[model samples]
Target: SSLTDKIKLQEEDKSENKKIKSFEELEKETRESSLKTLDDYFKFISELDRNDWFGVFVNAISSRFDPHTNYMAPDDKERFDVSISGKFEGIGARLQKKNDFTEITELISGGPAWRGKELEPGDVILKVAQGDGEPVDISGMRLDNVVKKIKGPKGTEVRLTVKKVDGTIKVISLIRDMVETEETYAKSSVVERNGVKYGIIYLPKFYIDFENKDSRDAGKDVAIEVERLKQQGVSGIIMDVRDNGGGSLKTAVDITGLFIEQGPVVQIKSAGTKKEVLYDRDAKVQWDGPLVVMVNNFSASASEILAAAIQDYKRGIVIGSKQTYGKGTVQNVIDLNQFVRGNTVGDLGALKTTTQKFYRINGGSTQLEGVASDVIMPDRYSHINIGERDLENAMPWSKIDAAPYDTWKKQDNFEKALQNSKSRMALNEHFQLIEKNAKWTKERKDAAVYSLKLDEFKKEQEKIEAESKTFKPITDYQNDLKFKPIPEDEVVMQKDESFKEKRERWFESLSKDIYVEEALNVLDDLQAKPVTKGEINLKKKGVKSK
Candidate 1:
């Protein structure tokens, strides 16, 4: 993956050979032209005639395939470090390539960008400016450079002209700072239904930095959280692994050990070799109580590893919409700087290569076919048909022999109880509401004619607003959105069909969360069972219901 080879091939083909010489040459040109820091460096780089700066990134990353990985060039090295550390001196917001514009995905909570009160998800930034003059139109600009321009020092302000979700245009100004907590971790909450209490833990991502032996580890912390909930006397625990794109392999093994007493968590079969077993070291079951795990299309890797282990051990019930992210490959960062001595590329970053695919003890590979849940929930992603199944180079799903564990066997009738619970839920009001919402979401997602004309847009927005009135907003999204408490117009609410319309809008409005409701029901079942014979000696506590 040499730049010379790429450039030579381009030249021989008589195609546009747009490639920078070396980071040194590029920086020399920038300095000779009087460019200084990141802002100047990026502005200068933006002037270069290259559409696929992705190539430059790829080459730079390849250097990491060996520890000698050095980009040699100063600017590229800075950018590389930021991406890996997941820390950047900028507004805490995620910008995505959306319809020829960098759309704001979500304002990271507690970030300076989110504090601006003007930036929001679905807002599109049309222009960026450091000063008050005419803004630099970033339309069609490379995503990397566009991001570089927006990120700056803690006190420096970056102005952004944006198109809001309401289809109005405005300018938002925000100062920047470093982002903490690179990887999302698991968080827990309590839920109650019919007087039964349940503990819910939402795991956003599995991250373990073995390179930096943390003073505190996420996996151990999560295990502690589970134990705390058990002490609180939850009837059941629901581990939510939705959108968890995974991190450390070792951490996944350690986390799974908390559920199963002592057994292999995941079996790794590398390139036609013997299968290697990763076993639990703790020999302690943190919470052997009634358990369920939640997953979605985005849960993969370490997330899959934990999920598969739980399922294989029959330690918990896997619940959610279909399969997970189906990413079971392990990647190691190789540093090229270490290998290619005297090469100018500083720490050439790293090359993340897929080394092995992991499988459950039962022989199922969480590759293309992610771990199938014990119960399925309705999701818009189900109909859209995206994931490992759609990818070209995706690995195929397979199975292996199941591993042995002997904890949940005591609750042999759990499946029958679960089936009975599911049947009851299908006829429940909350489940029906979620079904209606799912249908509504499918319609909106499938709509082909999304428009901005006031009448048309307002009609759509009004419909959504009306549907949202059925249930209180989940969490504090309304306040986060800076929703103002405008005086209610009874006449307006009456004149519009929004209020009277069915309150079952799906993706946009979670009027009824059937999965959560069902989960609560399961919790109730766990509670209905008599307290263990030995548990009566302890003081009793009344259960809280929601």
Candidate 2:
């Protein structure tokens, strides 16, 4: 039943003078409701044609090899392409189903919808029309079907009849165009601590356009961001790949090359082939200063590669969760249409199958065992089962002969800096609370059974909620740090209000991030300093005197 239905049922029960449901009666009703839902789902599945069943069967077969191997239908393939490429031809607005209506969540900056300034976030989409075609009332329609009706080839027209936030109905016309998902790209910010500036580059994924060589890729964009930071005279850089689930392998190698001199980034191995080492032949170091890479359990594949390479070379300190997502296998999408000559059967879609496995330059596979952080930090998922190891059919961890690579020796205080971070993490109260919360979360997750009786359930939930209230400070805690956009981003933000809002929100989060504060502290420790306290004080006095 829908939420509204459930609420109406409760109201009806209250209006009618009826005895409260007994535990057995409630349990029987709950079972009947669940069985009804299942029956409806099976009925829908029974109505599916052979093509849909064939796709499901194919996916089931492919998944048997590994969890990552799967089939993509035509529409699914389109979505996959957009995700990796970070661009799509559409109305450029994100939508969510709010009850029976589709609400606009966000308008992609620089896209037609944003440029028009007619459709805004919170506007409920009522009807959709293709060019001058008849409008179709989409009330209670599936969100995906609504999206299909709205998205089209570039240069086409999409007319949306939306109910505005002010309770006014208006028809907005927008020409569908190539919309780039800004969050998918690399972005950077500058922060100052103790009279030294540091750069923070957040790469959500190793995105690339396989069809377009000259397009923006994570590697190129990160290098650009690094150069921008260099121009700002930053003393250190923090590469934040936390929650990044990985993307292109080449982009990972390219991004890693920005920090170190020419070296092997990662090694690849096929089923029956010798290992192939991907080398960064470019000797030009974009940011050779003190470096730190931030990651969490969601960071996988390309993210692991970058972190592992940096760790192996002693290029940077990896901080955050105990380990990354541990996905080492590589996949290649094979277009199934290529096999048929002059095919008439609609698009057969593509198959993403594991082709090879990637290992760190140190020759250790980030499969079941991901890259362990140099300085482990406490997070909510600390005690939870996560990463590739959690998957039943995940690949095994292995090691081969270590690739010949030289460790970076520029920072003499590397060990000292790591120790300082570990000491700080040990003593931090916020982190301690976070660790406690993680244990509590794991305990709650393990205690799956719950009382279904209203009074008993309420009491149980109240007890849990009361305990959780103790950890509220973990979310409320904020560090006294300021993060600002670079001049280039600032200029862009000034022209685009939506972009400005997004950057400001990012800045707000950064200000509250204790992890970022600690990262900067580590960067400070990694700096080459005077031998003695007197000399450091003397240098500071001399600068003040000047």
Candidate 3:
């Protein structure tokens, strides 16, 4: 009950509801909207059958305990499985239902569509045509129906009328293929500054391919990357989990094992049971050098576990944002069909109920107060209401007995490095603009209801835009890095054309990463500070402005 603290929102008096003076006009519109809402609900109910309502009832009951606990129907279970497997047969682009069209949000690396290079994120799909056949306008269509139209058997072709982010229209054809989500996997690159090389590992998500178990492994892959960096004689390591939406818990524990020699990775406590400490008993440390973990508001669950463990151990400097996403619970999929017997009417799905809560080795639950960052940064989500505390009826934060562990053996100069970085960040113009923009965004969100008149609305919108325009070129920051793919990956990329382009794009992004540059700066300072004989012997790495 105390895993998430409730946010205290300052309430306005009821008198604020009477802002509009025209009561008669409001009453007239309210009746018309009431009928329209009823019509919409009726249409929604008309589309449901027996299983739909059954799933709804179970989910409604499940969600009462917390938001994470929910019942998944048959179709929902299949989709969940697909998401975990990270494999599907489609055009390999993630689509979201925008106002009237399906917008491409992200493209799977090495997929047929990504290799085509004709589509990009923010492009709107207006129509889908199968193999030169008559095109069907998909604007305003249901997302599932639109997906069905775009997907086909392998070897089939689908053409899309795409409205680009620049507002240009183009027709692009792509062959249907089984898409493997390469972006979810761990990738690494080498960055050089001040005569020292740093290894940067960007883990988008702690992905584990369950359907094809042998196909991918997050921990094993990361370990291999660390070994590759070690061969290059890297001075420090930076694990970037900024946007990672966590996945496999087992993988998270295993990945943490790669850092420390042997110790507890995390603690798990099931309801009505004793706590169990998951340990790395093998006494193997993959990268014993200086380490840093980067996280933002979106990093959660398994990501928090790794970051928390590292922080608790003082094994690395945790940077970015006020805190990580506060999700510290584990869920178990319960098959509802198992409970049904004796001529079960139809197929029941499963319930992914929260079964256990986790705790950091230092005894803090990352439920409400996520893993707090040591170095807070100015980011876009800083002013947003998007955390566990913002959720209705979220679990509160709590504490447990601290697990038996020792601080990192190489702990040295962390405080010095943190203070030095804070000083540098205070003078950074880009970060200053970010903080200003965050204030502006909060003010706009607080305004809430806006003027309905076209002229007034336009004036307000233009004013907001003009104020925000001062912070353009947020992506202009760049730092030089001698990035090289692992020897084994270079060999594979040589043969795979799509993989080569994807790797190139990844390198380009790294060049423009302001966060990565700052991380290296911290690592450099940590190394420069005096420490235990072997902890840090190098000089301060240089930072150059373009």
| C-alpha local distance difference test of each model | 0.61, 0.80, 0.76
Report residue 404 deviation for candidate 1 (angstroms): 5.2
Please give me the total number of clashing residue pairs in predicted model 2. Answer: 0
lDDT of 3 by residue, 1-546 (tens): 000000001122245554433445544654564465456546656887887777768866876788788888788888777766677888887776655669875577667777787886557787688998845667656566678888778899999977654333467999999887776788888867766788999887787766677877898889888989899889899999885758888888998989998888899898789999998887878888789999988778899999999999898999998898798888899887888677457767788988889899999998978898989887866876555666556777888888899888675678888987787678776777678766765666466476766457656655765766565656455565656776777898999987787888888777866677778888887784433433332223322335
1 or 2, greater by lDDT: 2
Each candidate's clash count: 32, 0, 7
10 residues in a row with least lDDT, candidate 3: 1-10
Q: For model 1, what is the C-alpha lDDT against the true structure?
A: 0.61
lDDT of 2 by residue, 303-396 (tens): 9999999999999999999998899998989999999999999899999999999888988898878999999998877986676776657778
In candidate 1, what are the lDDT values of residues 1-546, reduced to their tens digit? 122222333455644656646645644554543322346546766677542454556545644442122232345455655655676678877776654578775565347774455776557787788856546667666677789789888888888978654344566888777765632545455544434456776665566565778555668768877876776667788787765667777878887877777878888877878788888977677877777777877677788888888877777777777787777667655654677878874444444456677888877788778888777765545554445565444667777776655545645556754675656646554434445555655555455575645356546655664764442222222110111111232234366564323111211122134455455445444544743434321112211114
Model 2 ranges with Cα > 4 A deviation: 1-36, 85-180, 341-346, 530-546
lDDT of model 1 at position 347: 44
